[model samples]
Target: MQSSTKTPTAGGRAAPAPWALVSVLAANMLVDALEVSANLVALPAVGAGLGLPVPQLQWIVSGFAAGFGGLLLLGGRLVEHLGRRRVYLAALLVFAAASLAGALTDSAALLTATRVVKGFCVALTAPTGLAIITSAVPEGPARRRAVSLYSFFGAAGFCSGLLLAGLLTAAGWRWTLAFPAPVALLLLAAGARLVPRDAPGTRAPRGPGWHATAGGLGLTGAVLLLVYGLSHLAGPGREPARAAAAFAGAVPLGALFVAAERRSPRPLVPPVLLRHAPLLRSALGAAALNGSYVGFLLVATLHLAGSGRSPWQTALAFLPAAAPLALSALHSARIAVRLGPARAVAAGAVLAPLGYALYPRAPGADPGPAGLLPATACVGAAFVLAFTALHLQATGSVPAGLQAAAGGLYQTFVQVGAALTAAPVAALYTVGRGPALWLVTAVGAAGACVALGGLAHRGRPRARARP
Candidate 1:
């Protein structure tokens, strides 16, 4: 669990170069970004090769989403106990292994299971990488720029998958599934070099015993169910009663997670961070924005391509929305600074919903580039504007030591929102696009309300100036 090299920061020595940490974290994040989007282009190939049914194909994402969402907190905790370097290498090895398994498998069950296990491994390392960046760099303009670039790169990496999807998918699903292995291998190598060892300090690290493990298992179960419901509900005219059951089962299980976390000594989620007003808003806000954004996307995608457009054409038509996420992530910092973290959350909550509301009018009846382009841009911009806003604000005040945990908690909600929204709103489209779009509009607008509610607390006269 100990790091291999001596970390200068631990001894009041000069810290590692900011870029070093950023580079390392970027690689860490890049693979995660790839994992989320890479599978999209291969879905058709996967179905054909494996004799998979369309509805059951949800496992490509839902399985991973369920797994990733379930284990995030435990991932953060593993970092705390294991240290970033050890956990990062260990997880990436597992990640690469799982990716390889996904590549070679023709069995639907096996492939889906590999993706799920890969998600679990990714869950372990993803948060830890960001935490390492935060810990390596001092909080200031340097850390701000570093974090922004890292996040921006992550956002950019998502779009990069789209560009590469063409080449990789054309080559075959095996190529797409297996491609991430080299990236993971590179990160694992860099991890060995750039990462410093943590020498034993006076304080002993806690062993991640039964309670922590059990709490994580429970949380993972609940989130998996939550994502399953979301994706299942959204699939094309899928089974209604079954999806409803998934949603219903997930709800109480989620409650049980809250209960378990409270009871555990070494809780997967720390209580203070969980209950923080601004932080909670950010976590939930990321979830909302992604859910609405991705769901609307899924609907728009199906409508455009389902109407007989080529796969490449469908990807091209959606370009406007896809382009802005990386572009706007750069400005995320300015938004954070000008508005301060809390107000930024409020801003995202506000803009994102309004953007969703405009969806019906977007791309117009003609489906011309002018119409679709503007809408895609608006929605894409909304995510960066809001997501960055939330990220900056959410982690604004956490103690240096808890940075990893905060990241884990933040992403936990991110995937949960995605998982929860994917199918439900898509299912709503059955009533019509008019109804489905409105459903997303409503969901996004609700996040804006939550953000503003934080503002309400801000205005209540400061609690009589604390006497």
Candidate 2:
């Protein structure tokens, strides 16, 4: 790609802030994050307006996760082959079109289809955006700052969606679906201007071989089946047999994919990469961060709405979590530098479970700020520490060429973790909120243990054997 250099002005003065490229990238991150949570608060209204049955309504959310998570590996490869700038811009255009279609469609099926399309577009763009940032920015404080800001925008987007959903759903659910269009278009225009073009003499790489292609397709199918089954677990028409079938079908598919990968000339995911300890750990940490956070939000939102609180009130209650999360993200890079990313992640792990544990102690209906504040704050802190650290840890070790794939792998875990935890947590809520909170607590504790082990191991210097 074209290098981000200082373009001279008419007066022979250099342009201000080479970091403007990061702004374009962060905007993409913001839009991607916005899509994840915006439809959440608007779901009830969407169901009513579209006259969708409760079971089908759940698909509106799960569909996106399925498409995004399932295709991320392939999407990453596409970025590698086709070029980052090309893939990113094209994805934005597709996203805008899908958003427009979603807004205008009256058919629930068509709208749901649009969500999946938009999600696939996000799968392409999100990792590519990160890849671009890492490639463009020099590693160290500048890259760290860029990643932190990028992550902050994502967290902020989720919070913004919660509030925006309340307002837009009040006007009409369509507004929530349509909001991304204009924002995406503006980003597209700015991106065309600011984003450096592909390097001269660089042609798109050839596609993967048959074995790799087969493995990728099979793996994507397995993931989709798994996510689909998990999402159905807590729905109104809970069908154990169907869910079981889907889960069962995924096993052989996944195994076959692994087998195929072993034989492929050029596997979509390099086998050696899988053995990278830091990358694996970061993937696990990403999963834990998202699973616990989304699980907690799902339960908390349900509790508030069930207690006769309005949508606005429920959204407001979540402000404690969002506000602290934003602030923590802003400063997390500094914390990581001081404590080390592993230790920072471990610290987050501890806080997350502690937060979940506190939630169960909150008194009867409408547990005021006094009860919820500590729990939300802890969760927020966990997010800031874990999310930023994991992003750095996952990408820091990878070579330049594989950075896009690394980003894809990291994000795939995130979506899978969120989807997997959400259903079980929703089911637990039916039993009791206490059970749900306890489950989250257990998960957090486990994640913390992993992080701590990594920290202790990293701290100890390697001993040399006597010659």
Candidate 3:
């Protein structure tokens, strides 16, 4: 792989500083991560401001996941065809515009539309950013370090967003909605100046054949249906029949998608990619990590709300959990070298469930931050260890050309896992917080087992680089 340190200049002058490229990409990641959690804290305020019911308000969150997860494969394909730098800049422009529109609009429908648009833009930008990093940074230690830094920035971004949400919501929920616009605009400007242009002589891929087109359509439909059904599973005015129908519809579409991909000349997801055990393991680990974390967040938020904690207090309560994320992510490259990636991931997998288990053991109602500290710390540690390790594993396993696709696939698993687990956990929360916490524990344990098993098989040959 080429070193990310230097790119050819327009007039054969010196390359832009490496720090400039890193800053632009990391800032882009921060903006994306901020969107995931910032609005979460402001949900109640937004609902009150827009006179929206809880069911409708929840869509503001789910709509983003649906658009992000559903179109990820297509986004990856676009990155390949349209060029990474081109897609990245275009997506940032759309994201900035959407953030402004979302803040200005009073209509809930318009706000939701903006969320979906931003989500779609994120689908393009996130993976492409990763691809750009992989393309610029050579494989081995430097790339590992770059990936670690990238993951650290993402974790820090999520933490920052949670804190920002509370501060912004105090002024007005719209402030939280509008915050990303300026950040995105700044990143876009910086990115245009610093980000490397596409390699010379690179051209767009040919149009997809009929089978590839069919498979892509089917896969997109399946993902949308699946996410929509899962999001509504525990929602107010829940419709079991609709959820069931949506899920049932998805199965056949998914089956057809697989069949069509097998026959396509230019498949969206190549069959060989499925056989890559390391990538698959990393993807599963990522899914489990994200799903359980989001589930915990949902239950914890509900518990805090029930305890009559203010939004600010609730955000503050999560501060302890976010602290370890950056520390762990930054040092994960060294940890992976010492313990091996699979073992490090396994350790994190075990730690997360242990943390979730603590939640159920807390004495009485309103356990407070003091009671929550141990569990929150463990959860944060798990994110620090697992996310950085899994990111390195997945991205390292893929070839240069397919880095964006791998990133999209990895991120799709993340969003889908969160959506899938959130529904059941949210449903269980209606019964009791204890049950939901236990469910998260059980899921985390399962993921730990998978990670441990992968560790035992670490002798498997690494994937060969593609031409």
Which candidate wins on lDDT? 3
Please identify model 1 stretches exceeding 4 Å from their true place. Answer: 1-21, 44-54, 135-145, 202-204, 229-252, 340-347, 357-368, 397-404, 426-435, 461-467
* TM-score, every prediction: 0.83, 0.85, 0.86
Tens-digit per-residue lDDT, 1-467, candidate 3: 34345566678888876656776898888889889788877877787789875545655676676668766777766676778898899999999999999999999889977877888898888778877888876788877777766777887888888889889988999999999999898998998987788997664665445676677667767866775576556646467888899999999989988898787776777666777777788888788888888778777876776677767877888877776776566776777768778877888898999988887445366658778888898998887677778877777767878775576677777776776666667666655677778888887887788788778878876656462
Candidate 1 all-Cα RMSD: 4.9
Better of 2 and 3 by TM-score: 3
Question: What overall lDDT, based on C-alpha atoms, would model 1 receive against the true structure?
Answer: 0.69
Q: What are the Cα lDDT values of the candidates? A: 0.69, 0.75, 0.77
- For residues 1-467, what per-residue lDDT tens digits would candidate 1 score against the true structure? 12224356645976456587577777678668767666764565676678765445556766776678777777666676777778888888888888898899878888878877888877877666776777776789877777777877787777776666656866777888898888888888888877666546612378666666777777767766655565456435566687689778867776777777777875777777756666787787787887777666656654554455544555566666666777777776786677665676676677766666665543334455655666676776666566777776677667666665677788888876766676566556554677678878877887778778766665553211110
Candidate 2, 272: how far from true, in Å?
1.9
Query: Highest TM-score among the candidates is held by which one?
Result: 3
In candidate 3, how many Å is residue 122 off?
1.7
Ten-residue region with minimum lDDT total, candidate 2: 458-467
